[model samples]
Target: MGTLPVAKKKKAGRQKCSSKPVKLPDDASAEELARLARAVAHPARVRILRLLTDRETCICGEIVAELPLAQSTVSQHLKILKESGMIQGEI
Candidate 1:
């Protein structure tokens, strides 16, 4: 009888990854970084930021249409972003 071929075994250990350390500007303060973190803390906020980044300008109605949230909910998110200096709007 012919013997079955043995399968190759994969190494059982954590793979080593080489990465460069990120460098921040000297003027960037911890408070500023924390504020920025707070700005995109929510999933909806992150999505909103991504949408805004894709276009030079977008209206509130357009943002509302893209998200699953209601108009009011989107408005609140926009308010947070605006207050955090992550976005700007006209009166």
Candidate 2:
């Protein structure tokens, strides 16, 4: 019997968004736009936002399950989202 080779998991590095920034209307404050931009700067956070919007609610464990991240990492992402006013919840 041939043995299957196990693939090594690569360590995740910081990812940068390659898309150009959209010009917002003059009414929006630069600080507000920066805050919101920081909130979604990570792919994981974006995924979490999508997951929450899809169901209206979710626990930290649920979000962790959907992403390939650790519980602590997910919690950190959630914290950034909350601080940026992107999301709100006890978890």
Per TM-score, the best of the predicted structures is 2
Error of 2 at 10 (Å): 34
Model 1: runs farther than 4 Å from truth? 1-26
- TM-scores for every candidate against the unseen true structure: 0.66, 0.67
Q: Write the per-residue lDDT of candidate 1 for residues 1-91, one digit (tens) a residue.
A: 1111111112332111112223335798989788778978999988977676665445666667899998878878877866665654431
lDDT of each: 0.59, 0.59
TM-score, structure 2 vs. true: 0.67
Residue-level lDDT tens digits of model 2 in 1-91: 1111111122342221111223345787989899889989999888876676565234566667789999889878877876765654333
Candidate 2: list runs displaced more than 4 Å. Answer: 1-27
As for candidate 2, its clashing pairs are none
- Residue 84 C-alpha lDDT in model 1: 62
